[model samples]
Target: MISKLELLDNLKEDTGQLWGKMSAQHMVEHLIYAVRTGNGKLNIGCFNPPDKWPTLKRFLLSSRPFPREFINPIIGENLFPLQYENLEEAKKILEEEIKDYYRYFEENRDALLLNPTFGELNGSEWEAFHEKHFTHHFSQFGLL
Candidate 1:
């Protein structure tokens, strides 16, 4: 598993040349939104029960991928941010969210957490999904 610190460090690098998608700043904001969703702070505007997930998606969510889409991404406007600015501040907030996520998982790994897009995810499932999803986006922006 990639260390969270390492992932954060990579975010400092310029991604404009590496991934012609979102600016590194916007990318950081995007990351914040993701962490918030996992922590029960933000809702992605949809729901997918754990049973509704495909076998492949459930499996892949538990580990790092060889970089293909990593895992199937859900489609919805509310799941992601429509806009953002100030990459530095966004990164700081994102880092905080990640820490909170880790703490939450550590404390409640066995508890059932309500997921906006997956009804209720047990602690392990949430960790796997959060980690894999973050890794996927980090890789997408060339920061992994």
Candidate 2:
């Protein structure tokens, strides 16, 4: 297992040559989008229904397999689509966001945020999801 900081640093070395699709710039922007969620600037979805709240909560808290459909996104929402230009600028933005996310995780290990989809999570879950999900994509790009 790699430390979060180490994994982050390693991201700088990944050139996105093997991602097969996204340019390095897009990958960096995707990372930024995830970190922005923790920073309270991005909302995953608009709202949750009362009837499905428990199901949504369980999905967030439980160790269930993520549906394959969630892999691709549809646009026209608050969520930013993963596409970017200017590789150097995107890398700089991503690096700064990751640093901010790391500090937030360290300081707010038990705080709750109103996640648009998951409802809320303590800091650990937030950090775990962010790290794991980011690593998943990075690996998809052959970064690891």
Candidate 3:
């Protein structure tokens, strides 16, 4: 699974034809939110119960790829309001957030962040989650 940020440059508003309603800018902003969550900037709680986190995290950290039709329970079927001016700006912010994530983890190795889907995650777990997530979205836009 590819997790390269450079691959995101290949996306255009019209790029993805496979499935889902996300525009290119929406996808970038989504990624920005995800990185914020991992870096403790979002400060959200997990949706799953405590008992479910172990199982969920196991699934998350596994090598299996996310299915194309899969949808998060929180994000449902609708599109979210765009947060950036445009796709380019969204991509730039996403890059900044990714840099923040690296810096955040390097400074606070033991910090635990809530992932909404995976409960509390340490830096390494968040890293794994981000990689899998980026791979999924990048593949959706044919950037893989």
- By lDDT, the best candidate is 3
lDDT of each: 0.61, 0.59, 0.83
Q: Indicate which candidate wins on TM-score.
A: 3
Model 2: per-residue Cα lDDT over 41-88, one tens digit each: 676752665567667766655665444225344233234554545656
Ranking by lDDT: 3, 1, 2
- Cα error, residue 60 of model 3, in Å, equals 1.2
lDDT per residue, candidate 1, 43-138, as tens digits? 655456566656545554645453542232443333355354566677777778888877777876676666555556676677676676666666
* Better-scoring candidate (TM-score), 2 or 3: 3
Ranking by TM-score: 3, 1, 2
| Candidate 2 global Cα RMSD | 4.5
Better of 1 and 3 by lDDT: 3
- Judged by whole-model lDDT over C-alpha atoms, candidate 3 comes out at 0.83
Q: Which residue segments of model 1 deviate by more than 4 Å? A: 12-14, 17-20, 49-51, 54-57, 62-85, 116-119
In candidate 1, position 15 carries an lDDT of: 56
lDDT of 3 by residue, 1-144 (tens): 124988876887667646677877888888888899987789767788999999988998899987787777767887789978888888888888888899998999999999989999998898889889988888778777
